[model samples]
Target: MTGDGPGVTLAESGEFAVIDRLVAGRRQPPWVPLGPGDDAAVIACPDGRTVVSTDMLVEDRHFRLDWSSPHDVGRKAIAQNAADIEAMGGRATAFVVGFAAPGHTITAHAVDLADGMWHEADLMGAGIVGGDLVSGPQWVVSVTALGDLGGRTPVRRNGARPGDVVALIGDLGRSHAGYELWRNGIEQFDELRRRHLVPHPPYGQGEVAARTGATSMTDVSDGLLADLGHIASASEVSVDVSLDLLAADLDAVAAAGAVVNADVRQWVLGGGEDHALVATFPTDPPPGWRRIGRVLDHPGSQPRVTVDRVPWHGTAGWESFRVD
Candidate 1:
């Protein structure tokens, strides 16, 4: 499809001018020492340790222009990266973006993408401090998020103990349901389809968990079981997720499952990109998070992740360079 107006393709506007159009007039937070128009941004970290994570979304692999607009792609990129910082039990402070796209792409689409990025960042009370724009064969959006510790120690994946309880906050299976709806061309579940375009992460909840003495934490960017497997291996503990506890999550997407002839349980078990927060707590989980499992004291022979005492057979998580 052609651009919005002026027929200004990448060849006509060039990279720098397109970036100027994209970043112009965007507001940044006070913690951002330096905003866009620089090589990199400088952000304040009063607590000493900064939490950072990066993710790359390649066109056709991560998203399709036909299935999602540029605006949706931008929001998804920022949301996913922000969730990583949240998983570290930190608050997102700022973000830096690296974007590559075909030289023939419309300048208007690029600007719209940046608009969506800024909008999502504002929701988290963060800033898109800096970014780079370059030409490539297709769109490749990479985002790196920096976060603040807020004087609380970062909750890591390896910190779970034997008796800790597993908890989850945020809806599961929605994005996967959306994907199924889109793939099957089913238009019934608008909410699920929209969720696939832009995820709504549980903002500020990560820092809350950190302050509340959470032991281990991770974002559900990958499938639930796959992500818990990371914690299990790192903490040298076994995790058992109860299907009964997850029935609510399954029921939430049950309608969409029926439309596509897919299993709701598979979506809840294997869906990724929901950006939900999962943590291990020593006591009862705080409000807004539901207890789904418990940590076990097994060593070498413990199951990485299990559902109702059985090993789950669905796909686990996402990877960059996989043929499957």
Candidate 2:
């Protein structure tokens, strides 16, 4: 009955056994009234509403098994989805995942992936309440996160106003820097390399921003400017980022950029996947958040994001359909 025994493949164990191994011995949070093993999960909605977000990760596009362990991939999947919920100024309460993998994949790897998901969910006091498993040509992980707003109005991208301060909580460009290092086969900068494999999102900061008077907010899943551009377009405003304010982040990745013969500014400005929360505030940002820029009015004009009062010419963050 040991799915991990003898290096069993998912096909060898069949679907039910593989799923059993993944869900076995896992604990659920109090908010999750019903978890896996039921037809559907029952999550508490004390506020009478739930904030939901979903993301899909395909092998070789979002991650590569050769570069990322099953554990790393699992964490990345959950972290990204959780960030979406956080962007709305909510705390994640539960998740429902859908996993597809080649039948030839090892069952142990699948279990490890589940463990990784649980690891991240635990960090946010959430639970992986339910999921589905299926066979495919490659690995595909799709996660849907449900969150609680705690009686606060859900922050939206269109709420940013002119003169609002732009602040961020979490690191930036480290993942892109890590990707560059991995592509060049450089073995140094262990932390940057690890960051590319699994992102570290600032958990609970979303609710803090909302309570602290955040007008608009988003996680830096795409590059900074690109994600901010979303707020600009939705809010009908322009954003100007100050390079002077981002000195610390640039310095953080400068060494890695030099080693990789890349521009550190591009990484900090345009790199994505750090899942950092960037928001617009009317007053002083809360403690632990760094002020980076300000929002501007753009009435009857196309919304834009700028750096140092000028448009940036570097890579504009990741696009789902862009070909290199």
Candidate 3:
């Protein structure tokens, strides 16, 4: 209902009501010992190891309501953090969210956002568990996810050996291309644009990699090379990404690159937020993964991310306070 006429803002509907509507009609998985509507949801940790990770999305910084729906933003908040858990070779079990928005925002928007979060959480057989709502200058959503190791050792980022092969799953460069499209007012490539709004991570592949003897892994929240640099730095090894293996991804965005006067390869290698999974394996990687690079002996240079044996010149990765 509107404040004066037909349509009112979120400020009019109220926060509690919005949350109730958002949470209504959602279901959690059987392993979720506790679901939403509680202070915190608990899950069975038979292996006695729990994986936890958190991410924060600030308005304009992480998302724009103009570009994404409340639902889309909510899903993204959960998905990115969950990807962190998956990168550690764990299955997500629950989430706790914190939402900060203006008091005048419509309650319906809040509910819709929560609905989106729940929808995405359901995809991994997890639950929202609990969350907090507060007032703020702009919309701010923070999510922390808890995961179960299922009796397997958690995969860290420092285990790669010199002979380990680097592999990747999920699409690359599409999000960056989409971002370019949106920024430059180029209207072609609807699929790329949609990807900017919602990233599709390869679910369950992390565990598969873990089972297949993956030595190290991390989500590509940062760019492909930038993320791999984390592993390289931690393991004291060098990484060399093969451009040939990434040709298809570059091709996918070549047209978009032309439209925006950008290099598709740069997007493939440097653009982040696709949330793709990249891992290192001692043997052949599992199915659904593509070999992209190899680990090398550490030369004792300051930890760096490189491609073709040299530092990439494109925007390397995302930094919280920097602009592209």
Best of the candidates, lDDT: 2
Q: Ten residues in a row with the worst lDDT in model 1? A: 1-10
TM per candidate comes to 0.96, 0.98, 0.94
**Candidates' lDDT values, in order?**
0.88, 0.94, 0.85
The CA lDDT at 6 in model 3 is 33
Q: Write the per-residue lDDT of candidate 3 for residues 41-109, one digit (tens) a residue.
A: 677777887889999999998898988999999888988988998899988888989999997776667
Candidate 3: lDDT over CA atoms?
A: 0.85
Candidate 3 TM-score, true structure as reference: 0.94
Better of 2 and 3 by lDDT: 2
Residue 112 of model 2 has an lDDT of: 89
lDDT over C-alpha atoms for residue 93 of model 1: 90
1 or 3, greater by TM-score? 1
lDDT of candidate 1 at residue 47, scale 0 to 100: 82
Question: Where is model 3 poorest over a 10-residue stretch in terms of lDDT?
Answer: 1-10
